[model samples]
Target chain A: TQTVSQSDAHVTVFEGDSVELRCNYSYGGSIYLSWYIQHHGHGLQFLLKYYSGNPVVQGVNGFEAEFSKSDSSFHLRKASVHWSDSAVYFCAVSARAGNYKYVFGAGTRLKVIA
Target chain B: AQTIHQWPVAEIKAVGSPLSLGCTIKGKSSPNLYWYWQATGGTLQQLFYSITVGQVESVVQLNLSASRPKDDQFILSTEKLLLSHSGFYLCAWTRTGEGTLYFGAGTRLSVL
Candidate 1:
């Protein structure tokens, strides 16, 4: 079974400040990792994904994440955040052995204050 | 370009009511389709997936069932709705072997 954990339930930061949302996973075999953002009352939008190449993957809206095999982690980062960046971020993992079903982490709610 | 659309933008019903939600993908043929449910403030859970017409796989048993009637159409239905069934339901699709998923606006269901 694959499980994803997001240690932070909520994170608050000021506009123009950099922020990183943490995500960790436990899987035995090869897996795919991705990040998504959901605004209030909206469906999730894909941010980025990591599979085999490049430890670091860049996504839309100036977002990027680094995959660490040693840490079992894929953490999302932004150089600077805007007030519009306030949203719920989700980390999801899909095992190649488990088909297309993805196991998602309890999301981290980000609040950017202007 | 491809687009996904879910019908009945929002629904409110009483428990024990029959429910049906529909999704259609345009400009994309033979794409993999999926149904996902999310409770308020919770992560999205995969409920069902269909790779082809008349071939649907259940990922989680939530007392709901899904069917693919056409290559581009997917339907989710339940004979009886439960209070716990109230949540946001999303329809998504991607190419086979591609992990990127594109989602629709989603249907918000509220069971009283």
Candidate 2:
């Protein structure tokens, strides 16, 4: 079965510092990777997605992710964190394009301290 | 722009009581609709999906049934509420070429 793993249960970073949220997947087919952000008491918001062409995909709010086929991973990175960036980040994987039925990770909650 | 709407932003019900949750989709024709349940501090678990009007598919939902009564409406119903069923229920929709899911505000279900 397809599965996604997010090792970090929680992470803390100070404003103006760089941060990385890791995600790994174990799937046999071509995978479509995505990242979502959820604030407390609200629905999830799509951050970014990556498929065939580019290994690096940019998302809203200055977020970006890199897909490494060799590592079977997609990790999110930000050069400078802002206090508003504090939220729970979830990594998801889909088997095919437009299928959207995804296997999500447990999520990594980031606390950005100002 | 496409949008999804879910009713009863929050619901509080007693055990053995009937329950229903509604969702409506807009700006897309023959869109794929989905219902998902998320436990507190847990990831989302898909419950049901509807690919077309009047057709619905179940994923791992327990003691719940889903129906697509119209082209843009999906309904989730249960005969009796369970305390374990309390959590966040989300409604989502997507198109064949859209990899992203447009979600509703979500309904917080609290069963006693």
- Tell me what fraction of the real C-alpha contacts between chains A and B each candidate also makes: 0.66, 0.41
TM-score of 1: 0.98
DockQ, Cα level, model 1: 0.71
Evaluated at residue A30, the lDDT of candidate 2 is 76
List candidate 2 segments past 4 Å from native. Answer: A97-100
State each candidate's clash count.
Answer: 0, 0
Name every residue pair that clashes in candidate 1: none
Clashing pairs in 2: none
After aligning candidate 1 to the native by TM-score, how far in Å is the CA of A67 from where it should be? Answer: 0.3
Model 1 lDDT per residue over B1-112, tens place: 8989999899999999999999999999999999999999998999999888999999996999999999999999999999999999999998877788888999999999
Best by DockQ: 1
Which RMSD does model 2 reach against the true structure?
1.3
Best by TM-score: 1
**Candidate topping lDDT:** 1
